[model samples]
Target: MKKLSLLILSLGVLFSCQSASSKTEPENNPEIKMEENKTMQQDVTKKKNRIVVFETTMGKIKAELFEDKAPITTNNFITLTEKGYYNNLIFHRVIPNFMIQGGCPEGTGRGGPGYAIKDEFGPGLKHDKAGILSMANAGPNTGGSQFFITTVPTPWLDGKHAIFGQVIEGLDVVLKISEVERNKMDRPLKDVIMTKVYIVNE
Candidate 1:
């Protein structure tokens, strides 16, 4: 009878220890860890890139500013955008197979924010492809608020213009704007207005 009692107590202690061990075991689920890592990576990527959207009369054009490559130019653009500087402005110049130019407050491609930002020419930043966003200037170091987005690759403008961004979305809208009717001065016959322009920090 004593032997039976001893066996029962031993079995109880063993089961208790097994339960405690299982409860104390750390959770090392691989799927949960992978999901956590992916989320963190996405957050970091969003912080690194800055996007801007142009809600035009035609359609929305989204571009990613080259902040890492052209800090000064991007900063100037962000500041102006935050201040609604490009709102209600007209895309004065539209050249098919070339580019669409805008950001002129005068709606005649002759005005700016009353001050100029020094040209920022990052290495390899060139008008080498369609959708390239570049600063427009009459001469070197003369860029102010005026800018342009190319509809086709313009290699000749390299080194003479400050290429600060590229259209990531709405390239079709840019192309549509470029196809608009224009006068001899390249000014669009019907104004392609920028109804609103804003920045997206992602």
Candidate 2:
């Protein structure tokens, strides 16, 4: 009878130890762990990238900035946008079926954000399509705040300018800007003001 009680105690201790071991070893409870992990991942927020939106007098020309390809140029533009640098700035140069250039605070072809940035041109991105946004520079590696959006394919500008982004949602707004009346300098007679150039995460 004593031996039977001893055996029962030993069995009870073994079973208790097994239960404690199972509780401590998370891998043994994969289903619970997986559910917890899923909950954790769901609780973690997804990253959101800002979409460059050109709110002009005509309409909102939404664009997706190519930060991956032109980090320097894109960062410069984003900083300028956050500072409201492009506000009230006119599209100083507009050529039908070609491009529309702006971002010069002076509203002249010769202005910038008081500094220059290196060109981000390469084989990765190019001026292959209309509504493509690119930095306007006097020469190589002289890019600043001044930029242009192609109204058509401009292959010649491929390696010359920093292709930073493209008009994803409002090409028509860009087309309208291209059609505005302009002077001999290609400066618009009527202000094609860029009311705002802002960003939206995601």
lDDT tens per residue, model 2, 8-97: 999999999999998877466788989999888765533333588888888888888877677788889999999998888889999999
| TM-score of each predicted structure versus truth | 0.78, 0.80
Score residue 43 of candidate 2 by CA lDDT.
57
Model 1: worst 10 consecutive residues (lDDT sum)? 42-51
Give the per-residue lDDT digits (tens) of candidate 1, residues 104-185.
9998888999998898898878898899999999998999999999999999999888989999999999999999888999
In model 1, what lDDT does residue 141 have? 91
RMSD in Å for model 1: 5.4
Best model number under lDDT: 1
Identify the candidate with maximal TM-score.
2
The C-alpha RMSD in Å for every predicted model, in order, reads 5.4, 3.5
